[model samples]
Target chain A: MKELWELFSVFFRIGAFTFGGGYAMLPIIQREVVEKRGWASDEEVIDYYAIGQSTPGIIAVNTATFIGYKKKGLIGAIFATLGMISPSLVIITIIASSFMHFKDNQTVQHAFAGIRVAVVALVVNAVVRMWKKSVKDLVGIILFILAFLVIAFTRISPIIIIFVSAATGILLSYRGAVKE
Target chain B: MIYLYLYFEYFKIGLFAIGGGLATIPFLQELIQKYGWVTSQELVDMIAISESTPGPIGVNMATYVGFQTAGIGGAVIATLGLVTPSVIVIVIIAHYFMRFAEEPLVKAGFYGLRPAVTGLIAAAGFEVARVSLFNLQEYLDTRKILDIFDLKAIVLFGILMFVTNKYKKHPIIYLIAAGVVGVIFKFG
Candidate 1:
């Protein structure tokens, strides 16, 4: 029960603090869950993200759920997932009720603009870190370049690229080209 | 009953919406078109607001729609419905992932997956950088290369890039500092 509450609060902080969603949440999760709590490993977080990105629902929510379940099973999953959504529920409901006009507020707009820019740096840092660790071989380099281009230039779903990359890995291992 | 119905719809969305927050957009568009949930213009507005907010964009949208439809209770239910699938699916997947972690096929798949995830995130970073640093519309209107640059934003981005690499501080500190600077500079 104590661990479950810890999961809830940790995820609550993650959901509340991180803006510019999607990849922006990655570094925060890494620091909070992996570094602080020792709840998950760096490799495990990456795996959760890989699975989270490919699966259904929001990646952020999916990640919290996976980590929560890993630590304490079904109830832990519920608490963490709830914690993840709590801020959104409160903030959005409050805004919807009376502060919808805040959308046009200049101060709020400027702050978000700054947050967005800083978010770029965050994502870049994490990407650079992962690149060093993950992109070690030629196949890794090729897959990295191809995935980057396909995602950046084309309209293909990331899921398809992920599947193709997985198939490439499997086929290479089977052919004695790469050892996993 | 209406709340339950709305919640069920969100549950279906959760079940089928692959990828992540942005992936839920198409389904949202369909809902707006089919049921006039919030109108096309409102959906666009919601998207803009949702993107800048602190939570998952999809969850924010769901809450907004729920609030508009049935107030706070609706918002809570819709949010719950959206995440329910994730908890169920991930729990099931984790169960199997652990069981299969040792299989060569799984390891090989992971070898590919890790890099691809990094690649996808790099692409996402490029997108955030484009939004934060470039003035696409201004460049289009002026037809000048220099018009594309937001000099202030670029300066902030550069400073942040340097400092973040040097200090290795928690992201929250950088976020707070940048937000304060943005407000002071009137980034808009």
Candidate 2:
């Protein structure tokens, strides 16, 4: 029970504080789950993130669920998932109720404008970090470039890109193994 | 009835919105067209608010749309709907597939997936930059090169990037600082 609560609170804090969504949440999650709590190792966290990205649903929520389940099973998963979203639930409720009044407020608009720009920076930071970790060889670089171009320019669904990339990975690895 | 509809609709969204939060936008666009729950303009506002605020964009947008259509209870149900599929799917994977982390096939798949995920994230970042730094729509309409860039936003972005790269402080600190600068400078 204590562990469950801890999981909840940690994810809750993560959900509450993170801006710019799942990718932006990565560093904080690394700090809390891997570095601070010692629940998972760095590699394990990356694996979870990789899985989280490929799976359906929000990457942050999926990651929290994965970590929670890893630590404490089904009940742990429920608590962690609940904790992760609780902040958003409350905050969004408050915003929804009063958003109309503030919709046109100059200060609010300006603040949001600023926040949006910062969010772009944060996402770019996430990309840099992810690139350093994930893009290691020619195959990885090729996949990265292809995925970026497809996603940025075309209307293709990301799920297709992910599945195609995974298949490409499997085939490439298999070929490399055979060659050796 | 409304609760069920919210649940059913968002359940589909959760089931299919692979990649991450922003991926759900296409589905939400469909919902707007089919249900007329919110206008296109309202959906745009919701996306802006969801992106700017804390929390995953998927969950935030779900809550916003739910609140608009059904109130607080609606918000709760909608969020639950969005997450339900995730919980179920993760549990199944946890139970059946956790041991496969060492499998060669799975490892290969993940190897490919890592870079793909990075690319997807890079694309997301690019999208954000386009929205924040460039007024693409306006430039498209007028063909004015000067109108394309938001000079102030670019400057702020550059400064924040340099600071973050140098110091590696918490992201929230940078976010708060940006918010403050935006208000002071009356950006946008």
Candidate 3:
């Protein structure tokens, strides 16, 4: 119905414009779904973001699905995901056709160089924001630091780390040391 | 035949990638080493291009590899392959996530995820930095060793970081500025 089209277009615009992926997409989701549409409250959006991150998928797609379903159910989820991915699919198709031919073009190369630096800035901003909100207590801070170091210095796969941390959370909850 | 395998492989990646696009790098590296579809150098180049482009890095990389492997159709297959799992999972989760949202165990599980996700994000940051900024080959060659660091880039990074951090400016401003700098440097 009309609602489905709205969901599609809204997510289409978001997917088309969002450049840096999950972290960059976060604020857009917040503004559009939470503030403009009243689809979810601030806390709910945060919760969805956390869940979206932990779940097995692209964060933005997962988030859009969650929000879309929240608003309109199964059909909404389908439309939202389509909207989220369609732009990439189309754009990548075009790029795939042309990029190989222009692989070493100076303007393209220089543009990429600038974009990479900007990506660093984007990721840093995301980390700083999440750090303020996520690292609430000593244990959380410890986990953050330890996990960051383990990831940075070691070659341990992140999937293993996530599993271990989840287990730790369960055990801590069992011991009544932390309130989940 | 190969397209089906590629699809399934990326499906696995899409199914298990918990954090984001960058979290897919190590997984893709494993694929490259095992299958020979891509080389390490190509992976590095893909990362650079993917990050710079206007889409998800994983999708972009998948498309690039697919295009290289089997042309345009291959690119479509790979992109779809990488994205399909997430679409399926999200559809299922949407029906049930709220019912489970309140359970203490679920909360604890996600709480645990926060730190781990942070770790993944941090690792991704380090890897990109290492690839983009620290080119040891330039040092080994000794010619224009100083250019290895790309001083203009570093200064731009520093200024952008300070301005954004201090002023809490919108990210678009920085993106526009970077684009302008790229044009100036390229045409100058």
lDDT of 1 by residue, A1-180 (tens): 789889889888888876877678888887898888898887788788889988999999999999999888889888989989998998888778765677878898898889888988888888888888787698988888888889988999999988998898889888887664
Fnat values, one per model, are 0.79, 0.81, 0.52
Q: Write the per-residue lDDT of candidate 1 for residues B1-188, one digit (tens) a residue.
A: 86897789899899999988888888888877777767788888788878888988889989988888788998998888899899999999988997898888898888888788889888888888888899999999999999899999999999999999999898888888999999999985
What C-alpha lDDT values do all the predictions have? Answer: 0.87, 0.85, 0.71
DockQ of predicted model 3: 0.48
What is candidate 3's lDDT per residue for B47-79, written digit by digit as tens?
866765666667777778877777777777877
Chain A agreement with the truth for model 1, given as TM-score = 0.94
The DockQ ranking, best first, is 1, 2, 3
Error of 2 at A86 (Å): 1.5
Top lDDT hit: 1
User: Poorest 10 consecutive residues of model 3 chain B by lDDT?
Assistant: B125-134
What are the runs in model 1 whose C-alpha is more than 4 Å off? Answer: none
Regions more than 4 Å wrong, model 3: A1-60, B1-52, B61-78, B133-136, B140-149, B166-170, B186-188
Using Cα atoms, each model's DockQ against the true complex is: 0.81, 0.66, 0.48
Query: What is the two-chain DockQ of model 2?
Result: 0.66
Clashing pairs in 1: none
The iRMS of model 2 comes to 2.2
Q: What is the interface RMSD of each candidate, in Å?
A: 1.0, 2.2, 3.6
